[model samples]
Target: MDYLRVAGGRVLRPDGRVERADVAVDRDEGTIRAVGAPDEVDDAVGEPPGEALDADGSLVIPGLVNAHTHVAMTLLRGYADDKPLDPWLREDIWPAEAELTPDDIEAGAELGVLEMIRSGTTAFADMYFAMDRVADVVDRAGLRARLGHGVVTVAKEDADARADVEESLAVARELDGAADGRIRTAFMPHSLTTVGEEYLREGVAGAREAGVPVHLHANETTDEVDPIVDERGERPIAYAESLDALGADDFFAHGVHVDDSEVDRLAEAGTAVVHCPASNMKLASGMAPVQRLREAGVTVALGTDGAASNNDLDVFDEMRDAAMLGKLAADDAAAVPASAVVEMATAGGADALGLPGGRIEAGAAADLAVVDLDAPHLTPVHDPVSHLAYAAHGSDVRHTVCDGEVLMRDREVLTLDAAAVRERAANAASDLVERVESA
Candidate 1:
């Protein structure tokens, strides 16, 4: 019967309504038990059994979910930038990554998790390497995550490629349901272009047998799509479907170069696409057809990709970029409205990950973010939802709660030591650069 209450804030409800309310969480189960006006919730809960967070002058919204990321890439932030994806990976990122150790991965993950928590992200789906370290960081930081080791097989012998595939599957199986259910696992092939047909099919088959969903990069650029279409005689999505990779539980990252038919196929499969607008823009990758995907009944979520590409893991920035780019890409002023972008950052992401906590209501998981609207930039709050999409920044988040536990309060992260994490990651990055250069 442990309880924690968030009192006196404007709560964003499931249906996009905003009301002054108090949210009561059953700490034992980490679920919202009551949400109503302060006096009403007080009467319903008969006093918080443990603690209460004062949320006056704040807007309480569901914690944002980052649907796709490479969390440990925090070590590589600014290591390689202003280059396209292929050369950027081949020349800079891969060589540096080959020098990383498990400690390096943990340090980078800790830094990434610190960034996400401070920025009001409660959960994320990550496709990266050394995911056991990633899961450890997520659990320790009190955030929920779905993690998988990214598998790349191209330019390798069959034995080496098969070994990579096996390792990816092994990591997924070993890590699923770890960390008191705070961690989930997925099968992540780096990309359709990077993974050969036989390897992709085998990985997907093993994932299906293991009951894990698939996550990967697909159609990220015209370069990736043209070659696939030239060789397969169809779209990238068609090739993915041919290998039985399309499913309701599966989600893809960066479907930027997808065509209308590909969007239709994704919608038909009930699959989700995570839009990483900042990363795509920074890499000079083409804009994703977010409006078309949503119009086709596909669920679209927002992401920051990874710090190395986006240069920062900020979902608020992602929302703003998504709105601006969607309109320009579609050449319509109303292509992606503010509300749509807000939904993509919150509920859309949670839904895509098959987790709860996107909505503020009874029986929902108690994952929430508190934004200090008292700032001058947030003045004259014409519309809270509009503010979330068009005006807010990560620094405006004053508090973060996940699983009914207060992780950050008043701009201070409680579960993670931010200063220590930043120092460790800085040292790791410095050493990694030296090692790669020396080699």
Candidate 2:
């Protein structure tokens, strides 16, 4: 009979409407039990049980979902910049990553999860090394994640490449449904160009056999798309289809260079694309055709990619960047309106990841973010949705909840010691840089 109540707030509904309500949670079940006015919610609960969160004078929206990110890459934040994907990865990122230790991975992941919780993100999809370490962070932080080990098989001996592919499949099998069912898993093939055709087909087949979805980088830049077209005589999505990788359950990250034909293929296959607007802009990776894809019935979600590229894991920033970039990419002010970006960050992400928390409704997972609108910047509220998409920053988040558990309240994180995690991560980042330089 454990219960938690979020009282006296305006709850944002799934369809962009808001209403003054109190949301009640069955903490034992970790699902929302009721969402209505105080009296109605109280009546539905019958008796007050455990605790209540005062959401007075705030907006209660579903917790943000970050669909794609390399969480442990937080150690590389600001480590490399102003280079395109290949050069950046080859000269700076890959070399540095080759020096990462399990301990370093843990520290960076803890910091990333801490930032995400602080920013009101309750769920994320992460691809990186030492995924077991990442899963540990997600468990301790009390957030949800879809995690996987990224497999890169280029220029490797057959034995080594097979081992890498097997490692990805093994990690996916081992980690799925971990962390009290808060963690799911996917098979990650890095990208089309990085992993060879045989490995991609074998890995994807193994994933399908295990009933797991696949995730990968696709059509991220002209450089990535050009080679595939030159060799295969088809677009990236079409080549992905040839590998048997594109499916309703699969999602690709950073479809920044997808053409109209590729967009059509994505829509028809029911695959999703995670648009990392900040990462794309920072790396000059070109803008994703988000408006066109959505118009063609493609489900587009939002992500920050990683702290290294995005410089932050704030879905608020992603929302603003998506709206602004979508318009510029389409040459129309009406393209990718504020409401659409908001949906992409929340419901769109949930839909893409095949998870259940993204709207304030009964029987949904009790994941939510509380935004304090009492500040001067948020003053004279005309449209909350507009402010959320265009004006809000992650700092405005006052509380974050996931699975009926309060992860943060009053801007204070409860699940982990933020100050301690930052210190550890800083130390780890310094050590990693030294090791990379020495190597």
Please estimate how well model 2 matches the true structure, expressed as its whole-model Cα lDDT. Answer: 0.94
C-alpha lDDT values of all predictions: 0.92, 0.94
Steric collisions counted per model = 0, 0
Best by lDDT: 2
TM-score to native of every candidate shown: 0.99, 0.99
Model 2 Cα lDDT, one tens digit per residue, 1-439: 7999998888899989988999999999999999998889888999985988888988999999999999999999999998998899999999999999989999999999999999899999999989999999999999999999999998899999999999999999999999899999999999999999999999999999988899999999999999999998989999999888999999999999988888999999999999999999999999998999999999999999989899999999999999999999999999999999999999999989987799989999999999988889888889999989988899999999999999998999999999999999999999999988888
| Least accurate 10 contiguous residues by lDDT in model 1 | 40-49
Candidate 2 backbone overlaps, count: 0
**Model 2 RMSD in angstroms:** 0.7
